[model samples]
Target: MNSLKTNYNIVIVLFVSIFSFQTNAQSAAVDQLHQLYIQTINTGDPGNLNTLYTDNVSIRNSDGSLLTGLNNVKKQYQATFDNGKYDITLKTIEEQDLNEDYMFVSGSFVFTKIDEPEAVQRGTFVNILKNIDGEWKIYKSYRYPEITNIKSIVDGLYKSFAQGDIPSVLEAMDEEIIWNEAEGNAYADGNPYIGPEAVLKGVFERVGAEHEYFKLDDIELHEMSNNQVLATLRYDAKVKETGKTYNAQVAHLWTIRDGKVSAFQQYVDTKKLNDAMSK
Candidate 1:
């Protein structure tokens, strides 16, 4: 059994070494291909863009539009460049080889119209490249726009809370966060919690101490204009003091800025909570 285990380990090491060598050997080609693509964007010239793709390429645009054939893809890119000048940044997320002739590269990108820097767009992309006549070319491409910052940030906070990762939940808030509970709610005595530390002490700590279990239920995030997200949910909890359970309807209005939550206003069915707390 020990000899068998040793052989298995050797096989695994050899497999990894071979894969690493193959990847390293192909890295230069992939980098050159990406640089060529970037050069096309930099020059706003789609004339040479087709050289980066296979003749029968297909593109799945972020807007749900599709273009087939290298010529069609080149035309679409030309049309985009005609609209306005853009500055784009790309980041490679992962790359994997599907045998020797084909591989997939996935990455994220941020692009902005040079004239309107505030209107930045971010998305992720995938390129399936095939080796055609000793040259790597894109066989297929896909782009997906990133979700709005407000909803994404707020969603992450709720996820952290559900996982009992209190530090992460707090870290999402800005240093000067202003938090408020509904006026009639018992927690409102500390209305306008000024910062993360205050929120940790006055709200989260109290909630943990006063409840057997507390959960956010049926959370639906609505993206609002001007960097805010409205979350409709329910507070499901059992009060430790009275041993009574309550599932109160709740809503949270969160204002986010620079990827951190700057303000929070919570609306809850306070009467149900009061009844649960009372003997």
Candidate 2:
């Protein structure tokens, strides 16, 4: 009985030791992935980015656009460097070892462009990486961004509106955005325009043509539950042909999904606007 006990004890010790070594190896492999990512971003080199991805990788961008396969991934990186000239850095928030062959990593990132004084964007991401033939690669990823940056998105869209950046402004809205103009307003012909293009043609373009200085001022944002943001502001504008000015109270109820404005409701003193138009 004594001999049997000793043998059993030895087997338990060996099992524990093996587990410890395997776990260390697993962590080391995962760490390599993190290091490679940092290196790739800092370098702005597609060659480095390509090394860490599998042939069939799925990268969902912050704007909810999915880039599949190695080619699409490479193109995105190349464009960011060549056109945007942006550099990104990441830090891990949590790392989980699903098994010896797979791992999960969640982290935040800061992106800066060459001309910018500071980082332009801060975002989060969760990724799944796998080991294939002894090499670890990013296989799947769900970027927790877009709305991960609500302030930047909502503020930027309004700024674009101010600048007459029509394309940029339209691109920030969802395809099927539910946009409404205040009733009794001249542009309220379409009560709830169904999409970005419709809003562009119906509301924005008409406002541009009819108003000499259409502007939003005294803006205050109140973030609400369920991913809603309420903006209270004043619309200051002059009717072009009528040569009349009005300062009307305005409230915009915005619903965001996947980091884009999916719905928008406008409340305004439409009578004041109509009176100005009559002038």
> Using lDDT as the measure, which candidate wins?
1
In candidate 1 the C-alpha lDDT for residue 50 amounts to 60
For the record, the alpha-carbon RMSD of candidate 2 to the native fold, in angstroms, is: 5.7
Q: Put down candidate 1 lDDT per residue, 1-279, tens digits, no spaces.
A: 999999999999999999888898677777887788777777788867667989999998865568999788877888889998877778888888897899989998888888888978898999999998877889999987775666888999999999999999998887899999999999999989999999999999999999999999999999998888999999999999999999999999999865678899999999999999989
Worst 10 residues of 1 by lDDT: 143-152
For all candidates, the clash counts are: 0, 0
lDDT of 2 at 204: 87
Give a tens-digit lDDT track for model 2, residues 106-206.
Answer: 88887778677474676788888888888878989877563554656778888888887989899989889999887877888897899889999999889
- Model 1 residue 267 CA deviation (Å) reads 19
In candidate 2, where is summed lDDT lowest over 10 consecutive residues?
A: 144-153
TM per model? 0.50, 0.64
> Model 2: what TM-score?
0.64
After superposition, candidate 1 runs with Cα above 4 Å error = 1-19, 150-279
- In candidate 2, the residue pairs with backbone N, CA or C atoms under 3 Å apart (3 or more residues apart, or in different chains) clash, namely none
